[model samples]
Target chain A: MTGVLTVVGLGPGDARWLTPAASEALASATDLVGYGPYVDRVPGTPGQGRHSSDNRVEVDRARFALDLAARGARVAVVSGGDPGVFAMAAAVFEAVENGDPAWRNLDIRVEPGITAMLAAAARVGAPLGGDFCVMSLSDNLKPWEVVEARLRAAVAADFVVALYNPISSARPWQLGAAFKIVSEIRAPDTPVILARAVGRPDERIRTEPLSQVEAASADMSTIVIIGASTTRLIGRAEGEAPYVYTPRFYGVRP
Target chain B: MTGVLTVVGLGPGDARWLTPAASEALASATDLVGYGPYVDRVPGTPGQGRHSSDNRVEVDRARFALDLAARGARVAVVSGGDPGVFAMAAAVFEAVENGDPAWRNLDIRVEPGITAMLAAAARVGAPLGGDFCVMSLSDNLKPWEVVEARLRAAVAADFVVALYNPISSARPWQLGAAFKIVSEIRAPDTPVILARAVGRPDERIRTEPLSQVEAASADMSTIVIIGASTTRLIGRAEGEAPYVYTPRFYGVRP
Candidate 1:
């Protein structure tokens, strides 16, 4: 039996957002592997094996998946959003680059899905309508200085910024620190969108000015979008959430 | 009769990549409006009005969709990729913000899809697995100087940059000029990915060193990805595409 390894994204919380290509890959998979939450998202198959591991052990999990595929097991490595964006695709490639030479010859492919930022941006209006930058706020793999530098540069370039992994139980102060940095370069009234559990039943999207937003609002499930100076909010009649969007035109306000 | 407007993405080329949410919106739409090629992508439905227009008339198309929706038509304005990224979601919101006040009261939603960058990145390996910036190189909406500045800043920040609308028939010199700017800052052996007509039957993906990529290689359908300094390529046995990926670790090689 020739083994094939496919990494697929499940999109945000909604099953409707899952692509047909990903669904097909899951249905044909002989083995499913991912973090416990993501693996649990897949419906159990009759003979398919499920390997769920802790979130922090990406490298170990990747090696295990690669090993299974090497032994002629058809494997599907899953992530919550698009595998290319801070997900299992990179980890799998890292394992292939460093693991046994035979791993490179295994049939590996990445199936893209609707990433969290795109889903969150859709739930709110299109705040990422123009040029944008995506960065992870967690200082686990990189230093805080790098994050701060990217934030400052993105602000200077007037790019709408999406900050992933904004806060966690282990590190709570990073979001506050990031806000302080953005508040320095951007206008106080710049729109900030905090989207939590996007596409889920309990999804919540809130938009406020930079000065008014509290750092405590974000958790691990949250994605923080800081709008550019060109981003604007259109008010509704009464008791309604306003539409927030960045204009396609630059350097001029409608 | 109350009207509703929903903007949805068709994903990149392949129908299988389309999300169920987007498909549902398309099926429920009484009026479908978009650029000609995208409008032609949808299967014809009875009693549904399909309005196809020229490519450059985004604002006009958006207004027409809003007008139809205001008259109690269930409208869906489709774009090639995720509506939030350089697509119709922003254009529709721009129309709402500047057009009739009653349009604000209409139920408008954005259904996200798999954007082109993620699709192109998946066709290769996870080149955008690290921090990244997405920008359009077309100078129609913004100036050429702004594009140059953002490219320089992104390179300086060591970000994997995804360039959309890199080259079009109308303007041919932008890609060459942009490549010159990047070449000045990046290493000679840095990888650049030119993905043209991705997910289509005639799709082509080419990875070459920055020094070897030509300006004429890209067209309107192309998405150019310039990998970060940390990105590396893993070799395959023989006569196979090399796997390109950026390690999760930063400032150190895995």
Candidate 2:
């Protein structure tokens, strides 16, 4: 039996945000593999073996999934948010490209899901309504200079910036550096969103101006969004959360 | 009776890709409003009234949805893909911001879904497997010069660029101009993906080198992806579709 390997996104932390396609892939898999937290999110199924590993072991986990599929076990490699965005889909492809040549013949597919940025955007009323750039703040994969340069370019182009992996225990100062770079170029009144554990019960979304935003507010579970020049706030009645959005209209200059 | 206005995403063209949160919003809606094509995508309910409109009337459609909800109708404003990204969520928020203050008091929520780029990226391997930028080529909202400058900035930053609204019937040359701007800075071998009608029955995905990519190949339904400098093609055995991906590991030159 030629078993299939599927990479599926679980979507932020909400079960309701999970796509039916990804749900079906997980339900039908004989084995599931992913980071421990993501694997824990999947509903338990009878006869399905779960292989959960620690964070930062994406390639190893992907290789394990590929090996399971090669040995005739239907496997699903899962990730939080869309698998294709800084997640398991790329790692699976990398394993296939560099690992055993026979892994190429195995059926592999990526099932998309609602990414964290989209989920955060929805919760906060479309801060990413215009052109945007998504970048990882962690310099583990790339140089810090690349991150700084990309942030500068995004700001110069006036794109709303969605930052993932903004701050971690090991890389606590990167978010501050990023903020310093962006705050220098953007207006003081430009909106910045710090969304933590989006879609989860403990989800916290804070929207502040570029001048007042504190980089120390972000953590590993947080995703930060820096609004473009066009981003604005809709005033709320007393005690209500204000609606934040970047208008679709541009160039006319409000 | 206070009613709710929920803006939901239909997720590319596949019903299976729709999130449960969005599906629930649709099922509970007494009225639906969107562009004709997207409104048609929602499953018709016996009691649900569908209000379809022409394109480019986003604000008008949003107003209609808000009005329906204000008068005690549970209205769902739908968009293709995640409403937060270049879609209906911003329009809805704009209406609420500029419209009656009473509209602010009504219950409003955004239900996120799988955006087109994620769906297209999943279908074509992980072309956006790293840091990327998303921009729309339509000059309807922003200036052509802004688009050109943004494209140049994205190329300079070496971002995998995803171009939405690549070509419309009225704006056929924008994609070509975008292509010209990027090709001038990037390597000739960089990959360019034209994903048309992604997740639909008539979907077509073509991967070509930046040098050979024709801007005329794209249409309103297409989302074009330009790979970063680090993107690579995985060699496939005969008769197999090529796998394109950007590795998770960066800074180490290929």
Clashes of each: 0, 0
Best by DockQ: 1
Per model, the share of native interface contacts recovered reads: 0.88, 0.86
CAPRI class assigned to model 1: medium
Residue pairs with backbone overlap in model 1:
none
Each prediction's whole-model lDDT (CA): 0.92, 0.91
DockQ of 1: 0.79
Q: List the candidate 2 regions with Cα displacement exceeding 4 Å.
A: none
Evaluated on CA atoms against the true complex, candidate 2 attains a DockQ of 0.75
> Which digits, one per residue and each the tens of the lDDT, describe model 2 over residues A39-150?
9999869989999999998888889999999999889998999999989999999999999999988889999988999999898898989999999888998889899999
Q: What shift in Å separates residue B131 of candidate 1 from its native position after superposition?
A: 0.3
lDDT of 1 at A67: 92
The estimated TM-scores of all candidates read 0.98, 0.98
Candidate 2 has a TM-score of 0.98
**How do the residues A1-254 of candidate 1 rate in per-residue lDDT, one tens digit apiece?**
27899999999999999999999999899999999999998986899999999997888898999999999999999998999998899999998998999999999999999999999999888999999999989889888888888888988998999998999999999999999999998999999999999988889889989999998998999999999989999999799899999988787443
